[model samples]
Target: MVDYHLHEAIKEAGLDLTKEQMVVLKKLHDEDGLNQNELAYLTYRDKSSLARLLSKMEKKKFIVRKPSASDKRVNQVFVTSYGKEIFESAKPFVGKLIKRMEHAISETEKQQIISILKKVQTNLS
Candidate 1:
Protein backbone atom coordinates (compact mmCIF):
# COMPACT_ATOMS: atom_id res chain seq x y z
CA MET A 1 0.00 0.00 0.00
CA VAL A 2 2.70 2.43 1.02
CA ASP A 3 4.97 1.40 -1.82
CA TYR A 4 2.14 2.08 -4.24
CA HIS A 5 1.44 5.41 -2.67
CA LEU A 6 5.10 6.40 -2.49
CA HIS A 7 5.47 6.80 -6.25
CA GLU A 8 2.31 8.86 -6.49
CA ALA A 9 3.39 10.89 -3.46
CA ILE A 10 6.75 11.50 -5.05
CA LYS A 11 5.00 12.97 -8.09
CA GLU A 12 2.66 14.94 -5.86
CA ALA A 13 5.65 16.35 -4.06
CA GLY A 14 6.68 18.10 -7.29
CA LEU A 15 9.58 15.83 -8.03
CA ASP A 16 9.80 15.63 -11.79
CA LEU A 17 10.29 12.34 -13.57
CA THR A 18 9.95 11.15 -17.05
CA LYS A 19 8.95 7.46 -16.71
CA GLU A 20 12.30 6.22 -17.92
CA GLN A 21 14.25 8.77 -15.90
CA MET A 22 12.60 7.65 -12.66
CA VAL A 23 13.34 4.01 -13.38
CA VAL A 24 16.93 4.84 -14.21
CA LEU A 25 17.32 6.82 -11.03
CA LYS A 26 15.69 4.12 -8.92
CA LYS A 27 17.74 1.36 -10.55
CA LEU A 28 20.97 3.25 -10.02
CA HIS A 29 19.97 3.95 -6.48
CA ASP A 30 19.54 0.21 -5.92
CA GLU A 31 22.34 -1.27 -8.01
CA ASP A 32 25.15 0.89 -9.27
CA GLY A 33 27.58 0.20 -12.12
CA LEU A 34 25.14 -1.59 -14.37
CA ASN A 35 25.74 -1.57 -18.12
CA GLN A 36 23.09 0.02 -20.32
CA ASN A 37 21.27 -3.20 -21.17
CA GLU A 38 21.48 -4.47 -17.62
CA LEU A 39 20.18 -1.18 -16.29
CA ALA A 40 17.31 -1.24 -18.79
CA TYR A 41 16.35 -4.82 -17.88
CA LEU A 42 16.49 -4.07 -14.17
CA THR A 43 14.36 -0.99 -14.58
CA TYR A 44 12.08 -2.42 -17.33
CA ARG A 45 12.85 0.62 -19.47
CA ASP A 46 13.65 0.67 -23.18
CA LYS A 47 17.06 1.36 -24.67
CA SER A 48 15.89 4.52 -26.42
CA SER A 49 14.61 5.93 -23.18
CA LEU A 50 17.81 5.05 -21.33
CA ALA A 51 19.86 6.69 -24.04
CA ARG A 52 17.92 9.93 -23.77
CA LEU A 53 17.90 9.95 -19.99
CA LEU A 54 21.59 9.12 -19.86
CA SER A 55 22.25 12.01 -22.18
CA LYS A 56 20.19 14.37 -20.03
CA MET A 57 21.69 13.13 -16.75
CA GLU A 58 25.19 13.41 -18.17
CA LYS A 59 24.48 16.98 -19.17
CA LYS A 60 23.08 17.68 -15.70
CA LYS A 61 26.34 16.36 -14.16
CA PHE A 62 24.39 13.71 -12.29
CA ILE A 63 26.16 10.68 -13.70
CA VAL A 64 29.17 9.70 -15.69
CA ARG A 65 29.90 6.89 -18.09
CA LYS A 66 33.24 5.17 -17.85
CA PRO A 67 34.36 2.68 -20.46
CA SER A 68 34.88 -0.76 -19.03
CA ALA A 69 38.53 -1.83 -19.20
CA SER A 70 37.28 -5.39 -19.68
CA ASP A 71 34.67 -4.56 -22.30
CA LYS A 72 35.22 -1.70 -24.68
CA ARG A 73 31.64 -1.89 -25.90
CA VAL A 74 30.11 -1.14 -22.54
CA ASN A 75 30.15 1.83 -20.22
CA GLN A 76 29.38 1.50 -16.54
CA VAL A 77 27.21 4.11 -14.92
CA PHE A 78 28.59 5.91 -11.90
CA VAL A 79 26.96 8.70 -9.93
CA THR A 80 28.91 11.95 -9.83
CA SER A 81 29.64 14.00 -6.71
CA TYR A 82 26.61 16.16 -7.41
CA GLY A 83 24.47 13.08 -7.85
CA LYS A 84 25.73 11.75 -4.53
CA GLU A 85 24.75 15.00 -2.87
CA ILE A 86 21.31 14.89 -4.46
CA PHE A 87 20.84 11.28 -3.40
CA GLU A 88 21.90 12.20 0.12
CA SER A 89 19.37 14.99 0.22
CA ALA A 90 16.62 12.64 -0.94
CA LYS A 91 17.48 10.02 1.68
CA PRO A 92 15.71 11.83 4.47
CA PHE A 93 12.49 11.96 2.48
CA VAL A 94 12.83 8.26 1.71
CA GLY A 95 13.50 7.64 5.39
CA LYS A 96 10.38 9.52 6.34
CA LEU A 97 8.32 7.53 3.82
CA ILE A 98 9.80 4.32 5.23
CA LYS A 99 9.02 5.43 8.76
CA ARG A 100 5.44 6.03 7.75
CA MET A 101 5.29 2.52 6.32
CA GLU A 102 6.75 1.06 9.53
CA HIS A 103 4.21 2.84 11.60
CA ALA A 104 1.36 0.87 9.99
CA ILE A 105 2.70 -2.50 11.05
CA SER A 106 5.03 -4.43 13.33
CA GLU A 107 8.40 -5.64 12.04
CA THR A 108 7.15 -9.20 11.91
CA GLU A 109 4.02 -8.18 10.06
CA LYS A 110 6.02 -6.16 7.58
CA GLN A 111 8.23 -9.16 6.90
CA GLN A 112 5.23 -11.40 6.52
CA ILE A 113 3.53 -8.98 4.19
CA ILE A 114 6.59 -8.67 1.99
CA SER A 115 6.93 -12.44 1.96
CA ILE A 116 3.36 -12.81 0.86
CA LEU A 117 3.80 -10.26 -1.89
CA LYS A 118 6.88 -12.04 -3.13
CA LYS A 119 5.09 -15.34 -3.06
CA VAL A 120 2.28 -13.85 -5.06
CA GLN A 121 4.78 -12.61 -7.59
CA THR A 122 6.36 -16.05 -7.84
CA ASN A 123 2.98 -17.72 -8.04
CA LEU A 124 2.11 -15.55 -11.02
CA SER A 125 5.33 -16.59 -12.65
Candidate 2:
Protein backbone atom coordinates (compact mmCIF):
# COMPACT_ATOMS: atom_id res chain seq x y z
CA MET A 1 0.00 0.00 0.00
CA VAL A 2 0.99 3.64 -0.32
CA ASP A 3 1.62 3.91 3.41
CA TYR A 4 4.02 1.01 3.37
CA HIS A 5 5.92 2.45 0.43
CA LEU A 6 6.12 5.83 2.11
CA HIS A 7 7.45 4.23 5.29
CA GLU A 8 10.14 2.44 3.33
CA ALA A 9 11.03 5.62 1.51
CA ILE A 10 11.38 7.52 4.75
CA LYS A 11 13.56 4.82 6.23
CA GLU A 12 15.66 4.56 3.08
CA ALA A 13 16.17 8.31 3.34
CA GLY A 14 17.71 7.67 6.82
CA LEU A 15 15.03 9.46 8.77
CA ASP A 16 14.04 7.76 12.04
CA LEU A 17 10.41 8.80 11.86
CA THR A 18 7.16 7.00 11.27
CA LYS A 19 4.54 8.16 8.77
CA GLU A 20 2.31 9.19 11.66
CA GLN A 21 5.07 11.29 13.16
CA MET A 22 5.90 12.86 9.82
CA VAL A 23 2.27 13.79 9.32
CA VAL A 24 2.10 15.46 12.72
CA LEU A 25 5.42 17.19 12.15
CA LYS A 26 4.32 18.53 8.78
CA LYS A 27 1.06 19.77 10.23
CA LEU A 28 2.83 21.55 13.06
CA HIS A 29 5.40 22.99 10.69
CA ASP A 30 2.71 24.30 8.36
CA GLU A 31 0.75 25.84 11.20
CA ASP A 32 2.92 26.41 14.19
CA GLY A 33 1.45 27.06 17.63
CA LEU A 34 -1.63 24.95 17.19
CA ASN A 35 -3.22 23.86 20.40
CA GLN A 36 -3.64 20.18 21.25
CA ASN A 37 -7.31 20.13 20.32
CA GLU A 38 -6.66 21.74 16.95
CA LEU A 39 -3.82 19.35 16.23
CA ALA A 40 -5.92 16.34 17.19
CA TYR A 41 -8.72 17.49 14.90
CA LEU A 42 -6.39 18.23 12.03
CA THR A 43 -4.60 14.90 12.43
CA TYR A 44 -7.87 12.96 12.77
CA ARG A 45 -6.75 11.60 16.10
CA ASP A 46 -8.66 11.56 19.34
CA LYS A 47 -7.45 13.71 22.23
CA SER A 48 -5.90 11.00 24.44
CA SER A 49 -4.25 9.27 21.51
CA LEU A 50 -2.86 12.52 20.19
CA ALA A 51 -1.56 13.31 23.66
CA ARG A 52 0.38 10.04 23.77
CA LEU A 53 1.80 10.63 20.32
CA LEU A 54 2.72 14.17 21.26
CA SER A 55 4.43 12.86 24.36
CA LYS A 56 6.69 10.68 22.25
CA MET A 57 7.37 13.48 19.78
CA GLU A 58 8.18 15.73 22.68
CA LYS A 59 10.68 13.23 24.03
CA LYS A 60 12.31 13.15 20.60
CA LYS A 61 12.58 16.93 20.78
CA PHE A 62 10.57 17.24 17.59
CA ILE A 63 8.03 19.49 19.26
CA VAL A 64 7.39 21.51 22.35
CA ARG A 65 4.04 21.98 24.01
CA LYS A 66 3.56 25.12 25.97
CA PRO A 67 0.73 26.19 28.16
CA SER A 68 -1.49 28.62 26.33
CA ALA A 69 -1.11 32.23 27.39
CA SER A 70 -4.83 32.82 27.29
CA ASP A 71 -5.91 29.50 28.73
CA LYS A 72 -3.84 27.53 31.18
CA ARG A 73 -5.56 24.27 30.33
CA VAL A 74 -4.64 24.41 26.67
CA ASN A 75 -1.25 23.39 25.34
CA GLN A 76 0.11 24.91 22.13
CA VAL A 77 2.38 22.79 19.98
CA PHE A 78 5.36 24.18 18.06
CA VAL A 79 8.05 22.56 15.99
CA THR A 80 11.54 22.91 17.39
CA SER A 81 14.59 23.78 15.30
CA TYR A 82 15.54 20.12 15.32
CA GLY A 83 12.03 19.25 14.18
CA LYS A 84 12.38 21.64 11.26
CA GLU A 85 15.65 20.02 10.33
CA ILE A 86 14.10 16.55 10.36
CA PHE A 87 11.14 17.76 8.29
CA GLU A 88 13.47 19.37 5.76
CA SER A 89 15.48 16.19 5.58
CA ALA A 90 12.41 14.12 4.82
CA LYS A 91 10.95 16.49 2.21
CA PRO A 92 12.89 15.15 -0.74
CA PHE A 93 11.95 11.55 -0.10
CA VAL A 94 8.31 12.49 0.29
CA GLY A 95 8.50 14.51 -2.92
CA LYS A 96 10.01 11.58 -4.74
CA LEU A 97 7.26 9.27 -3.51
CA ILE A 98 4.64 11.75 -4.65
CA LYS A 99 6.32 12.07 -8.05
CA ARG A 100 6.38 8.33 -8.46
CA MET A 101 2.70 8.06 -7.65
CA GLU A 102 1.78 10.87 -10.00
CA HIS A 103 3.90 9.39 -12.75
CA ALA A 104 2.07 6.11 -12.39
CA ILE A 105 -1.32 7.69 -12.94
CA SER A 106 -2.75 10.01 -15.53
CA GLU A 107 -4.26 13.35 -14.53
CA THR A 108 -7.76 12.22 -15.49
CA GLU A 109 -7.38 9.06 -13.50
CA LYS A 110 -6.18 11.09 -10.56
CA GLN A 111 -9.23 13.31 -10.79
CA GLN A 112 -11.53 10.33 -10.99
CA ILE A 113 -9.90 8.77 -7.97
CA ILE A 114 -10.28 11.98 -6.03
CA SER A 115 -13.91 12.33 -7.04
CA ILE A 116 -14.65 8.78 -5.97
CA LEU A 117 -12.88 9.29 -2.67
CA LYS A 118 -14.90 12.45 -2.09
CA LYS A 119 -18.12 10.58 -2.71
CA VAL A 120 -17.03 7.85 -0.31
CA GLN A 121 -16.31 10.50 2.29
CA THR A 122 -19.70 12.04 1.74
CA ASN A 123 -21.34 8.67 2.17
CA LEU A 124 -19.44 8.08 5.38
CA SER A 125 -20.38 11.49 6.75
Candidate 3:
Protein backbone atom coordinates (compact mmCIF):
# COMPACT_ATOMS: atom_id res chain seq x y z
CA MET A 1 0.00 0.00 0.00
CA VAL A 2 2.76 2.41 1.01
CA ASP A 3 4.85 1.44 -1.99
CA TYR A 4 1.94 2.00 -4.34
CA HIS A 5 1.42 5.51 -3.03
CA LEU A 6 5.10 6.30 -3.25
CA HIS A 7 5.25 4.99 -6.80
CA GLU A 8 2.38 7.25 -7.75
CA ALA A 9 4.09 10.18 -6.07
CA ILE A 10 7.29 9.56 -8.01
CA LYS A 11 5.38 9.28 -11.25
CA GLU A 12 3.51 12.49 -10.57
CA ALA A 13 6.77 14.23 -9.88
CA GLY A 14 7.97 13.29 -13.37
CA LEU A 15 10.79 11.16 -12.05
CA ASP A 16 11.47 8.41 -14.55
CA LEU A 17 12.88 5.98 -12.01
CA THR A 18 11.20 3.64 -9.60
CA LYS A 19 11.53 3.80 -5.80
CA GLU A 20 13.68 0.66 -5.83
CA GLN A 21 16.04 2.20 -8.34
CA MET A 22 16.13 5.39 -6.28
CA VAL A 23 17.21 3.36 -3.28
CA VAL A 24 20.09 1.77 -5.18
CA LEU A 25 21.15 5.16 -6.47
CA LYS A 26 21.01 6.53 -2.91
CA LYS A 27 23.22 3.72 -1.59
CA LEU A 28 25.75 4.24 -4.37
CA HIS A 29 25.70 7.99 -3.96
CA ASP A 30 26.49 7.61 -0.26
CA GLU A 31 29.21 5.04 -0.90
CA ASP A 32 30.57 5.70 -4.37
CA GLY A 33 32.11 2.35 -5.25
CA LEU A 34 30.43 -0.77 -3.95
CA ASN A 35 30.84 -4.24 -5.37
CA GLN A 36 27.78 -6.11 -6.63
CA ASN A 37 27.64 -8.40 -3.62
CA GLU A 38 27.79 -5.45 -1.24
CA LEU A 39 25.04 -3.62 -3.09
CA ALA A 40 22.86 -6.71 -3.09
CA TYR A 41 23.30 -7.09 0.64
CA LEU A 42 22.67 -3.45 1.36
CA THR A 43 19.59 -3.35 -0.84
CA TYR A 44 18.27 -6.71 0.40
CA ARG A 45 18.11 -8.09 -3.11
CA ASP A 46 19.32 -11.37 -4.57
CA LYS A 47 22.24 -11.26 -6.97
CA SER A 48 20.16 -12.21 -10.01
CA SER A 49 17.51 -9.58 -9.29
CA LEU A 50 20.14 -6.99 -8.57
CA ALA A 51 21.80 -7.88 -11.84
CA ARG A 52 18.59 -7.16 -13.72
CA LEU A 53 18.18 -3.84 -11.91
CA LEU A 54 21.77 -2.94 -12.69
CA SER A 55 21.25 -3.84 -16.30
CA LYS A 56 18.35 -1.43 -16.56
CA MET A 57 20.26 1.27 -14.74
CA GLU A 58 23.27 0.70 -16.98
CA LYS A 59 21.19 1.02 -20.11
CA LYS A 60 19.79 4.29 -18.80
CA LYS A 61 23.39 5.42 -18.35
CA PHE A 62 22.68 6.15 -14.69
CA ILE A 63 25.35 3.83 -13.40
CA VAL A 64 28.39 1.92 -14.52
CA ARG A 65 29.83 -1.38 -13.47
CA LYS A 66 33.55 -1.88 -13.73
CA PRO A 67 35.65 -4.92 -12.98
CA SER A 68 37.43 -4.39 -9.71
CA ALA A 69 41.09 -3.58 -10.15
CA SER A 70 42.14 -5.98 -7.43
CA ASP A 71 39.61 -8.67 -8.24
CA LYS A 72 38.85 -9.34 -11.86
CA ARG A 73 35.72 -11.29 -11.07
CA VAL A 74 34.17 -8.65 -8.88
CA ASN A 75 32.17 -5.84 -10.45
CA GLN A 76 32.07 -2.54 -8.61
CA VAL A 77 29.04 -0.30 -9.06
CA PHE A 78 29.36 3.46 -9.34
CA VAL A 79 26.91 6.24 -10.06
CA THR A 80 27.69 8.16 -13.23
CA SER A 81 27.38 11.94 -13.55
CA TYR A 82 23.89 11.44 -14.91
CA GLY A 83 23.00 9.25 -11.95
CA LYS A 84 24.12 11.96 -9.54
CA GLU A 85 21.86 14.44 -11.25
CA ILE A 86 18.95 12.06 -10.98
CA PHE A 87 19.73 11.48 -7.34
CA GLU A 88 19.73 15.21 -6.71
CA SER A 89 16.44 15.59 -8.52
CA ALA A 90 14.90 12.87 -6.37
CA LYS A 91 16.03 14.38 -3.07
CA PRO A 92 13.08 16.76 -2.68
CA PHE A 93 10.61 13.99 -3.28
CA VAL A 94 12.46 11.70 -0.91
CA GLY A 95 12.44 14.39 1.74
CA LYS A 96 8.70 14.86 1.33
CA LEU A 97 8.19 11.12 1.53
CA ILE A 98 10.15 10.95 4.75
CA LYS A 99 8.40 13.91 6.25
CA ARG A 100 4.99 12.62 5.28
CA MET A 101 5.65 9.26 6.88
CA GLU A 102 7.13 10.72 10.00
CA HIS A 103 4.34 13.17 10.43
CA ALA A 104 1.80 10.37 10.30
CA ILE A 105 3.12 8.82 13.52
CA SER A 106 4.26 10.01 16.87
CA GLU A 107 7.84 9.35 17.98
CA THR A 108 6.72 6.89 20.62
CA GLU A 109 4.54 5.05 18.17
CA LYS A 110 7.38 5.00 15.70
CA GLN A 111 9.70 3.44 18.25
CA GLN A 112 7.09 0.86 19.15
CA ILE A 113 6.59 0.01 15.50
CA ILE A 114 10.31 -0.41 15.08
CA SER A 115 10.46 -2.72 18.06
CA ILE A 116 7.58 -4.78 16.76
CA LEU A 117 9.23 -5.06 13.35
CA LYS A 118 12.48 -6.17 14.94
CA LYS A 119 10.65 -8.87 16.87
CA VAL A 120 8.93 -9.96 13.69
CA GLN A 121 12.30 -10.19 11.95
CA THR A 122 13.70 -12.22 14.83
CA ASN A 123 10.78 -14.57 14.70
CA LEU A 124 11.19 -15.05 10.96
CA SER A 125 14.88 -15.71 11.36
**Global lDDT of each candidate:** 0.73, 0.94, 0.91
lDDT of 3 by residue, 88-121 (tens): 9878877787788888698899999999999998
lDDT by residue for model 2 (1-125), tens? 99999999999999888898999999988899999999999998999999999999999999999999999999999999999999999999999999998996988999999999999978986
Model 1: per-residue Cα lDDT over 2-109, one tens digit each: 556666655655654343554566678777788988887776568888777898988877788888889989989977777666565555566677787688688899
- Residue 109 in candidate 2 has what lDDT? 99
The C-alpha stretches of model 1 lying farther than 4 A from their native spots are: 1-31
Candidate 3 lDDT for residue 80: 98
By TM-score rank, best first, the candidates go: 2, 3, 1
**Backbone clashes counted, model 2:** 0
* Error at 6, model 1, angstroms: 4.1
> Please, what is the TM-score per model?
0.70, 0.94, 0.91
The collision pairs in model 2 are none
Q: What does the lDDT come to for candidate 2?
A: 0.94
User: By summed lDDT, which 10 consecutive residues of candidate 1 come out lowest?
Assistant: 13-22
